[model samples]
Target: MDQISLALLSVFFLLVSIVWYSWIFKNWTKKLPPGPRGVPILGYLPFLSHNLHIQLTDLARKYGPIYKLWLGTKLCVVISSPSLIKEVVRDHDAVFANHDPTVAGLVATGGVDIVNSPYGPHWRNLRKVFVREMLSNKNLDDSGPLRRYEVRRAVRNLYGKIGTNVDVGELIFITEVNVVLCLIWGGALEGENRDKIGARFREKVAKFVELLGKPNLSDFFPILAKFDFQGIEKEMKGVLPSVDEILNSVISDRMKIMEDSGGEFSSANRRKDFVQILLDLMKQNDIVIGGTDTTATIVEWVMAELLQSPHAMQKAQQELTQVVGLNNIVEESHITKLHYLDAVIRETFRLHPPLPLLIPKMPSKSCTIGGYTVPEGSRVLLNVWTNYKDPQVWENPTEFKPERFLNDDDNGKWDYIGNNFHYLPFGSGRRVCPGIPLAERMVTYLVATLLHSFDWKVPEGVKLDMEEKFGIVMKKSTPLLAVPYQRLPSLDMYE
Candidate 1:
């Protein structure tokens, strides 16, 4: 070997050691919030979990409101308190509105959809279309019949399973899929028809979600992000084709529906599902990825909690029976009268928010949070699970008490949205779930109808397992097994 080559190698090694020690002992030690100690360069990546929501919530209890976590080369600061969450996600909303360009987001939104779009004119337009056509109140009202029809179909299925063990997760997943499909394609899946439009939509949506939140080394290290070292691109490559096929077929079908009617579908007198409006957008601004995942997650969590909390379930059922009697189907009109059911749904959202660390919020420029200086592009996470469960904000925070929401003084004040930030399941800000109203309707109607028409109980030997398995959303660790009995004969629920 040459003498100069050895000399240059020695110089490089010395500089690398100096930088590594500087990040740990000098630069990061004082600036970053308190967190577990870790080795050089790698940091705390090994200490993290696949279900980061649960992991972060535990850490927040130990470390306080703001805590630091390192993923590969970058430092991520998580905010769990409501005051900081409001200050960051609202007051400085625009500053932290940009996405972190993670592989999960890129794959989920097809890298161009509204949910993943960079903060700019394109994102603004996409949000407008989502709110105006896809998620507008007028459209929700127009699709009320479709929702009612789906709810009836679900009730029939539940009734048939009376006295027999059933996997409620599979039942609810299929039911929610049909609800989304009817809204997406204007139809439902019938028995033995495996290749139906609804089935196709579910298949595509499932593949997209399964791949979206999977970990990727590229996300943590930008220099390797484009290279796709962890085969994230391969997984996405397999998912995108199915997603495109489903959307494209729906696009074509909507064109036919319009032609047959000799006019464009009206929000007042139209199916007005997601796909129909998506086709009309001209540019196909964003994939409807969030629609399926977010909705499915909400449904799953709502059902899981209902199955676990029998008293809460019975209270909802009692209200549902009174509001929607036997022989009658639950309608949009019934949603308002089922107050207990609404409270149950709200409790589910509070305890198990779909996106634990809502789409990572990045600062547009350097800023100060909790007395610490954060640089531009530093990734920030709103640890919603922590905020929702904070004992200081909620009474008996750990208990699943739906009655806490019932007003005691008869003043009729619903404290769901108030000053203390007790609930932010849909988040709060310019980027709040645009699908909030639609989600609320589906959850309310489905819960009210299911509880109204059937009595659900866990199997003989099996206790309702409340352990959570985290995905992009928190889900039940084990699928719920319940025997749904026909509504008590005197209840006349299905009359």
Candidate 2:
């Protein structure tokens, strides 16, 4: 009986050894992309940097455009070059259509929401509703007044502090919050109450965003996520309730108003405005954050870059003066006509895309990119930042040059839609950002309003700080502090 038991144990060990070696051998022969091999079990997790985009780009330089790295048990493939990017996002796009949500991501969005949802029938349905109801051109145009009102309010507020310094990012952020929040629900939040809650809500949302980028062991080794080794998931849960509480309160107040008003505010033909509403999808932290953060950050970057490059700033102002004139205020309609301003926007995007890595795409099956096998479920990060700054793609890439976008050689080439692989600020294929129309309009209009309304310059000895703080949303290390004075013809124009 002892000999029989010993024989069974030996057979089990032998089977395990063979399977493990076979798996290793298979991966070795699969033509996987080259990358640094880290310590056993932990893989390259220990070596990652806080500025994930810059760190990945540095690795790409050493390992070529396509490279792989292991973060714990997970495989991360970084795609940097344009040609290789096309392979994954266009050629084999279907295979990489899915998103591999991080442990923190799944918690914040609960495996739901359009941004983090797995690509499938359900996601497709959500996208359909999002595009149709929220982002369609008609919907955007109908809601233009709401956006314009917010911008005008911002302009007025800045006018009050004509000589005083203002935080460009914070002001734009608060304004955007109002636009998205008020547009989605309505006058549910009004007067002084809205102002107090809006400021507090921004802090809560910012806190949630800060947590998402924190290094989480659960993200790298998700199998043990339930153990909450790092407590990131637990912390994320703690954050969500606060965010949900604000959202629910706003929505609940709106619903009560509708009920008390005999559903007058819930009219079927109602425009999405400060007073009109209807939509049960009230857990809109994702929408509000996405809409506000990216747009506001870009505006801040645009202003920072312009401040650094006086020539560009003068040119933009010159064009604005010609297009909008001194007597008039910046209207959304004026945004399209401001050619130099458009180039400035593209330049800023090229230099500093809000989502530097874009939302990471995960493949459904093993696929080949640049002759290397990217195994199924690998976290594929499309390095838009690297592509944007590649000297091969841009002339003097690191230099802040808005004219590169306006060059006639690439006439009609540098568009927001990612058709020309080299310039993809908004990404490409099916999963491209659906909010481009709204985003482009908002950022352009807001920047145009600021530029057209005020001649901005950093205070003496401020050094025009453009240092970036890396996060899910790239923020100015120091929020832009510039003095604004009346550039418009009259104060009534602001009103």
TM-score of model 1 (CA atoms):
0.86
Model 2 is weakest, by summed lDDT over 10 consecutive residues, at 273-282
RMSD of each: 4.4, 5.1
The residue-by-residue lDDT of candidate 1 on 283-350, one tens digit each, is 34233555455666666667767777777887777777677766676788988887777777777777
Residue 429, model 2: lDDT of 90
Give the candidate number with the greatest lDDT. 2
TM-score of each: 0.86, 0.91
| Cα-based lDDT for every prediction | 0.69, 0.81
Off by over 4 Å in 1: 1-30, 188-204, 260-269, 280-289, 408-420, 488-495
Candidate 2: tens digits of C-alpha lDDT, residues 161-259: 988888998898898888887785554445677667668777877888888777777777665688887888888898888778777776676667678
Residue 265, candidate 1: Cα error in Å is 5.0
